[model samples]
Target: MKNKELVENYYKDVFINGNVDKIPVYIAENYIQHNPQVEDGQAGFIKFFKNFIKTEPKIEIINVSCEGNMVYVFYKCSLPDGTINKVCDIYRVESNKIVEHWDVIESHVEKIKSVNHNSLF
Candidate 1:
């Protein structure tokens, strides 16, 4: 599969659906995570997602793009606790598997709280 497609599938299966069992199919065994909060490798990925899935955040993919082996995804997540977050996820694919990942997350501010009154999405 193409790099963009691979990463998108990974996000849908793991993040959107909370299906950790499919990790081996899309993630490399030695997956490198640049996010300081998460650990490296597939084991770490599984551990982190297992806990994250407990809340079952609703994920909406906004955009997806690819450059070389890198794929970038922009999305929004709404947690069950009423916290909304906008996230940009970057992934590096090798041999049809996601080998690396980095992400930036920002909490969405309500329109009433923003001076510009613009949506974060």
Candidate 2:
């Protein structure tokens, strides 16, 4: 599969659908996570998501871009409490498996609260 499709499917199945069993299909055994909250490797990934899914957050993908072995995905996550977070995730794929990940997450700001009056989505 293409890198973009691989990462998108990973997010859809794991993050959105809460399917942790499919992690091995897309993630490398030595997966590196740049996010400070999550540790390294597939074990850490499963551990983190196991807790994360309990929040029942919903995800909506905004955009995707791929170049070489890297795929970048921008999306919005709506927490059960009605708070929204905008996230940009970058994944590095090698040999058809995602080997590394980095991300930036920001709380969604209302247009009225913005000096530029622009939507974060």
Candidate 3:
């Protein structure tokens, strides 16, 4: 698979399914996750995400784009309490594996309350 496809599938299988087995396959050994809550490497990334997914199972990816070594994705996560958050993630690929990642997250309180707010993610 191409780097973009690998990343998209990795998010689906791992984040949505709460699977950690795929991390070793899709993430580089020296992977660096830039999120403040996560440490360096895939292990830290997996641990952080495992906690996230367990608490927020209704995560969905809305869109993804790839350019050169970078992939950008937008997503929405519904917390167990019904609050929703919108998030954007950027991944840098090297040798067909994700080597670096960064993300931004914001709570979509108003959007979540509006029944007409169709999820973009």
The best candidate in terms of lDDT: 2
Error of 3 at 13 (Å): 0.9
Candidate 2: stretches off by over 4 Å: 108-112
Q: Give lDDT tens digits, candidate 3, residues 9-120.
A: 8988888877888888888888988888898987888777777776865877788899989999888788778777788989999988999999988876535444565744
Residue-level lDDT tens digits of model 2 in 1-121? 8898899899888988889999989999999999999999999988998898998989999999999999999998988787788899999999999999999888753222766756777
RMSD of 3: 2.7
Pairwise TM-score winner, candidates 1 and 2: 2
Per-residue lDDT value at 4 in model 2 = 86
lDDT of 1 by residue, 5-114 (tens): 88888888888888889999998999999999899999998899888899878999999999999999999888877888889999988999989999888875332366
Alpha-carbon lDDT of model 2:
0.89
Question: What overall lDDT, based on C-alpha atoms, would model 3 receive against the true structure?
Answer: 0.82
What's model 1's lDDT at 25?
97
Q: How accurate locally, in lDDT, is each candidate?
A: 0.88, 0.89, 0.82
Which parts of model 3 are misplaced by more than 4 Å? 108-121
Q: Between candidates 1 and 3, which one is better according to lDDT?
A: 1
RMSD of 1: 1.5
